[model samples]
Target: MTAGLLAPPTLIRTTRGRAVVLGLAAVTMAVEMASLVVGRSIHIGSQPLSASVLPGLVLLAALGAPSVGRAGDRDRLVPFWIAMAAGLLLGVALLSRTGDLADLLGLVVAAANEEIVYRFAVPVVLATALMVLRVPTRAARVAGYVAAGAWWVLLPGHQAQTDGAVAMVTYASFAVISTVVVARSRALIPMSIAHCVLNVITIAHLRGDITSGGRGALSACLLFLLVGTFAWPGDRPGRRAAATDDGDQDLVTDTVIDLRDGQRPSVHRGEDLTWVDEPSEDDQPEPVGAPGDRRSANHGPPRH
Candidate 1:
């Protein structure tokens, strides 16, 4: 069931279908944005429930929901583990300096929600829209990813930081890398983890946990860059193996069918032939002079 939601949408064969998908995505985004606004306004025990919890729940649901069909390669744990490790190290580094539990919680929630919205949902919608508009598949995909990443970077909520250019570049780079991972790998979990790491690092940096000249900052950046390299689908060792296995299975199935069909006897006539009984080896031949044999008996009258 979880696999279904992570699957890609069915190809839009008809223009009407594409339009409907695009329209639905647009409406959903609008509703989500509205909810975010309302959630931001309300507070619960000094924390906004909508801002912290609601988006995460929504993302969780999306992740679990069924999709049209499985797309891309099967899920691999290597990339996920790599991302988690990087996130953990970066998160620890950030948390150590800030030592604020609320900030940590906030960053966690933001990571999940933002990744779902910007990396997963938006790019998918835009790609579908572009395909519907008759754009080439590769071009549509690239455009969708780039556009979604750019949107996240330029969002007003994300812009409330110092050094506008640096913030923009930093977040935008993260967005692009995350989006690429999602696009190539067709899996959100890894990128989401990476995003969370970025959020933690950024928040820590903003809080002056890592100064401009700090080595910790440089280490975080390098670790993140390592995480980004895993975004490419070809980097997974199991991917090619999985593809090869699928091909082999297909070939075997086809061969079996062909062999079975080819070996079947062909009928030359329109109608089936009648069955004829053959004498068995155990059966005795009819007696030469049985009671019914009149020729063997002496005849009283002879032919004149």
Candidate 2:
């Protein structure tokens, strides 16, 4: 199957969607940076809402990302909660190693803002563009992250410290890991929040809340907790209720995925992971023979 078919529907499914989100991010980023040029010192971020966060928040709201945990989507919440836990743990663990920290809340907020723009927005838009160009899904995902990772290291002079050969390699490795996470989780919020935590801990240190040799202790306990979100309790990741097409044989497996943006009833096969839209009643074959006929016994072509 083509990557176009496997492509998960994101907020940027269409060019218009991409344009709107990327455009908004651009405007917001400009405004945020311009603040530093002027007299406002909000560049370091603030307690509740920072200038950096405004753009990300507005874009997220526009894209309906926060709706992932709504009543209809409760089953998809495991990944989100697990992400939060992993982020918190990672934050505390890094404190002992990191030195000369910035404002904890400010750093967290700034990182969260970066998560929205770098981790979520750029990848989604870039991946969508690549898919539209018929690029392979895996390549598209990897390429999509180049901008985010590069921006984190290249754009701001502050990130130059992490630009050594080793750091570059690590960042590249992380890009791959995060690409896989985005593919599997299919939800931006989890990845975004997780990224925010990852970015800040090195600078903020557990929200700058506590201190101890617990650093080693916390470091030892820095379990990723990402694998825990592979599927819901007793729920396989790829399994879906079979959709009998009345003329085809389907071999679905034991994996369940929660698609982004609440698109319902997409069928995923084993490792291929191809997504097929649910067949409408009109698409089903008409009944054969007469009533009481064995061939005609598909429940009369499945009522609407």
Candidate 3:
């Protein structure tokens, strides 16, 4: 598997994808720093860093959720949702030491900002560009993951202490999981909730006392789960469904509706389109060609 993955096309595409996503993430980071500076001056707060950073994270997630979610929709949403709910309950009980609920308040802002910045905006933009540039999926996935983690590390005090470090790790871990889950599920809602739940847990933990060793173990477990989930056969979402002569597993991508919630599906470049061409009043039917037309014969039979 390793040798095959290192073939020429794969190597070149992976390298290119890494570079593209890295470059985009670097630029986005610069913009975020500038925005933080601007936002700080215009605001009043003792914890200005938190104030500045949380909103940035939220906006990034919001911007990217649709596309990322679409990519992840095929996965088992049940496990993802269960993980979130359980994580949330544990987080509230163990992490939120202040018990004031306000300590968790910063979390709301953080979730919004981080999801957009790390999960949605950065991944979608970078991944799309890399894929367009013919970057290999493996490389694109790695680059996007690293870029998101880098964004977390660069946060104001993300690296300053053991606690901050722990929080950053779990928080970033959440993003990583959400990305995979989102791509696998090919639907955004569950992953978005998962992302939010992860943040809420981190915030709660910040207020409580969790041993470093325990944190490390938990991180390891989550990371393991992420890898395991992605490795499962056809259980994940991707640039397209399983490729075959028949294309039996193909999904209609052009206009995926968010059936999980009432929200309309956001469009992405390469999703299945069979779902979109359904007979809606707004759709314009293709013209039937002349009797001798080869085009009609080649248009092929409509997929079920």
Candidate 4:
């Protein structure tokens, strides 16, 4: 309603791609939100249904949005490490409160659902709308990140009251960090895993698993950050990455999925059809009769 009513007539008529993207964005949001109810009956045998994955699956079936919230191999590790740091702060903030198993489960479900809402749906729709209104792609995306984080902090049933309003600033900071990572990677897995790990860490403290209490949990979180930061594979395969002088860290998403076309083109390096106009030296097949060719044709002795 906000988009259609207020959209400039000039833009509405002048721009067609924006309209298509906007329509796609709307459908993506609607499908994800509606699936929250319709997906209740979605079951996969004995294991509990991961409602978090349902919206993504529905997008796949209805819209053919294969890349939505899905990670690519080249997605960077700095953002992921940042996500874990944010989750660590969140777990530490929750230490003062009393929580049980039910709370732990509740946190997990909330993390999943809220990520879809704040990170997945909100960014998609908002960015498209902003773009339709003449905002540049990068600025609109930044605004979307801010909007998602704001809602994450302000939403009543979500992260707002998680700490009894004690660390509201911490919650706000966490929201910002979470949204930025999600937007940058265009994948929910990093934030999702970090958040779930945080849930377990919090519950472990509450359940006496961490014998030294918050201190032990803090140690665990720190240790995780250390190992994951050093061990994380941030670079694309067949590439080596060091922090460059120009800050060339691959921070943002590589491909954009348009629901109108529904073509999730594989943009993997060296894999996609459009990866090269002509094969590189490494990609060139060996010449059969060339001296240096590894698979040169066997000599015909009868020719002598």
Candidate 5:
């Protein structure tokens, strides 16, 4: 049987990864404190920076999120900015409809937490793990985002009407939309902008609105979004890789001259090998050494 622990996988940690993790830490602390002070009460009102902060957060992220893009390059900035602009327009429209700019502003801030939790924390963690497990990067990022969504949904005291449903949609969107934007822009600017603006609009539209089935719908939508995002063919295929041991342990293949009647192939060092399909008493031809053998050819017969 194959046996031995593999080395820990390596990850190309990026600024966005740090932002996501750090951002999550900040958000969790802020929300927990907000929870303690508010106690199941979420204030929904208009604020001055509702329109501005979202843009500002995008700008700030623009300065750092480029490295997270594909090939770790800075190619995706323009489209990302455009998406953010579009989202900003949508947010303003929703703000106009709901007349709750303050709540929208709050959403902008709260939405950043998602970046921390999913865009940042979960992706980084999963990417790191995948690097170790040799999982495909595309698969890793998508899986990571979905995992983060599940984590948020299951957090304690998450209200279905207020937090649960809303969080589900917002986080689900973040997972897919961010992947798309980052993939295209190779920069976080556009995606962050889109994210901020989307939250603004969502919060604005949610203001003074109530529906009974929103919770179930939100939960279902979250699951659906996660599945679709992962299944989508956005990410590039990974490179082929092979493992090698140090210089002293060059691999050697051996043929089976004999088997114990019913010996079967088994795993060794994470590889599989098959023995010759012949009975032990068949008395195979005399074994001969071809290469890499230190022992004499006239030695004992090969065993399977």
Candidate 6:
């Protein structure tokens, strides 16, 4: 059991694994819909748990499942740390103002639950299904991301209850951005932290901790700036270097194979794919005689 838990995500390559992922996705949607019909949150003391059991399970499965393509290559933690700092600030601000431990706990749990469902599980399963069906990688990924965002926007009862067009648009945009970030990075850690921060800000605003729209707007801008800066591409130097090395190695291997198979190997040196030809023995220059011997022979001939 311990070995299985630690095993690589090779199972996701199998048809069975794909089926399982898809099944989990279906179950997650069903449970979320049911939760909407019933109560969205279950209160246990001051902390309320979002009814996201299936979605949470799906996240756990994704953690263990093997993914196709470059899923493993994109897990950067720096952005998550930045987001965590922002979340801590939000939490601190809320606690300082309200002194309500229940609200704080509820915000944390809600944020985590929402991210696990909409950002991690739903997208992973949808993308995995698309990949199994041999969809183009980028298209599949984009489709999965859009699907997750749509799920959040269309299915949630709270979102439906939100008043005004501006508020709805703002909420949708926030969900979409969070989904895109998680999809592109293929890591939930950063998104979870970011979501927590957003939730705290939202709850605080709703609770009147933030008196005006201006302060809320400022907080939102700062949060976006922090997450965006840290999550920007090439931010993790080590991961970028590793990806570059892997790509270079793959290119070299492909070139070698093509050469061995008597095919013209087009090597991408810089921007151009230039064909390289193997040098033959006849192409090599012949050895020349030493200067002293050549001079002596020439002088003797001149004398004769």
Tell me which of candidates 3 and 5 scores higher on lDDT.
3
User: Where is model 3 more than 4 Å wrong at Cα?
Assistant: 1-31, 37-76, 94-99, 123-149, 162-210, 220-239, 242-304
Q: After superposition, how far is residue 87 of candidate 5 from its true place, in Å?
A: 5.1
Compared with the true structure, what per-residue lDDT tens digits does model 5 show for residues 164-271? 566676555545655544333233333344456645444544663424365345434433332232222443231001111111000000001011111332323333
Worst 10 residues of 4 by lDDT: 246-255
Of candidate 5, the 10-residue stretch with the lowest lDDT total is: 248-257
- lDDT per model, in order? 0.49, 0.46, 0.44, 0.47, 0.40, 0.54
TM-score-based ranking, best first?
A: 6, 1, 2, 4, 3, 5
lDDT of 4 by residue, 88-153 (tens): 555545543643334444555555556655665567677656655656556766787687678667
Candidate 2, residue 8: lDDT: 22
Q: How far is candidate 6 from the true structure (C-alpha RMSD, Å)?
A: 14.0
Name model 4 segments beyond 4 Å from true: 1-57, 60-110, 159-166, 206-304
lDDT of 5 at 81: 47
Better of 3 and 4 by lDDT: 4
For model 2, the stretches where C-alpha displacement exceeds 4 angstroms are: 1-41, 44-52, 66-102, 127-142, 155-158, 199-223, 230-304
Listed per model in order, the count of residue pairs whose N, CA or C atoms clash below 3 Å is 1, 6, 36, 0, 10, 1
Give the Cα error of residue 256 in candidate 1, in Å. 33
Please say which candidate is ahead in TM-score: 1 or 4: 1
**Which structure among the candidates has the greatest TM-score?**
6
Task: Estimate the TM-score of every prediction.
Answer: 0.54, 0.48, 0.46, 0.46, 0.39, 0.59
**On a 0 to 100 scale, what is the lDDT of residue 143 in model 4?**
84
Q: In terms of TM-score, how similar is model 5 to the real structure?
A: 0.39
Best of the two (3, 6) by lDDT:
6
Mark the regions of model 5 whose C-alpha exceeds 4 Å error after superposition.
Answer: 1-83, 86-106, 130-142, 152-159, 162-174, 183-187, 207-304
lDDT of 3 by residue, 1-304 (tens): 2212224222112334333333444465456667656654322222223343544443333223232333223354456556666766665565345454443444444454554456544554555455445555446545765676677656655555437556676556555565555444333434444445545545445645555566556545554444444334354444345422212121111111111121222224443233221345555345666556556567776555
- Candidate 1 positional error at 58, Å: 3.9
lDDT comparison, 1 vs 2, better candidate: 1
